[model samples]
Target: MREYSYFVYLMASRWNGTPYCGVTSDLLRRVVEHREGAAEGFTAKYGVSRLVWFEQQSDINQAVLR
Candidate 1:
């Protein structure tokens, strides 16, 4: 099994458009969920699904701080 650290990420509605900041352990899955509208919230409503930036961290605290 592959181990993954927490990730701080930014999702954009479009190029240079609205940006949504978030943290997750599974970036791929989380992004997919956002794209498919699987999780109800701001990202789903605003269609902020494109991944703009991401940073990996060792722990949740660091991910949150980033």
Candidate 2:
């Protein structure tokens, strides 16, 4: 079977600032989107663009559960 990886990530506006949690199969692309405010949503509105934390998972379900 082909191995797959997913990520549970946290982004913040600043140090101990507003936070956003998300799960994605493409962490880099997702982070870039947040950084660029490409999506019109909470992260864009709240300026949550700094990558604060992340965890890797073996499956989408595991990443979502995290």
Candidate 3:
């Protein structure tokens, strides 16, 4: 089995707030970027900065399809 570093994650504004689904290799950095509003996008606009769920995949294809 080859090593991989892909992740599918979910971010939310609050426990019941709107959820945002995404994929990234660096989960920490991505979350931080979202929190800091590094880019003006969906997560930033909807305040979906809280990590709610995550799962790793073997590759980008798998991660994206997930």
TM-score of 3: 0.88
Instruction: State, as a TM-score between 0 and 1, how close model 2 is to the true structure.
Output: 0.93
Residue 48, candidate 3: alpha-carbon lDDT:
79
Per residue, candidate 2 scores C-alpha lDDT tens digits across 1-66 of 899999999999999899899999899999999989997979988999999999999989988988
Candidate 1 residues 1-66, lDDT tens each?
666699999989899877999999999999998889898888878888899989999889989988
Best by TM-score, which number? 2
Which has the better TM-score: candidate 1, or candidate 2?
2
TM-score of each: 0.88, 0.93, 0.88
For model 2 the local lDDT of residue 11 reads 92
Task: Name the lDDT of candidate 1.
Answer: 0.89
Worst 10 residues of 3 by lDDT: 39-48
Instruction: Flag the better candidate by lDDT, 1 or 2.
Output: 2
User: Model 2: which residue pairs collide?
Assistant: none
| Model 3, residue pairs in steric clash | none
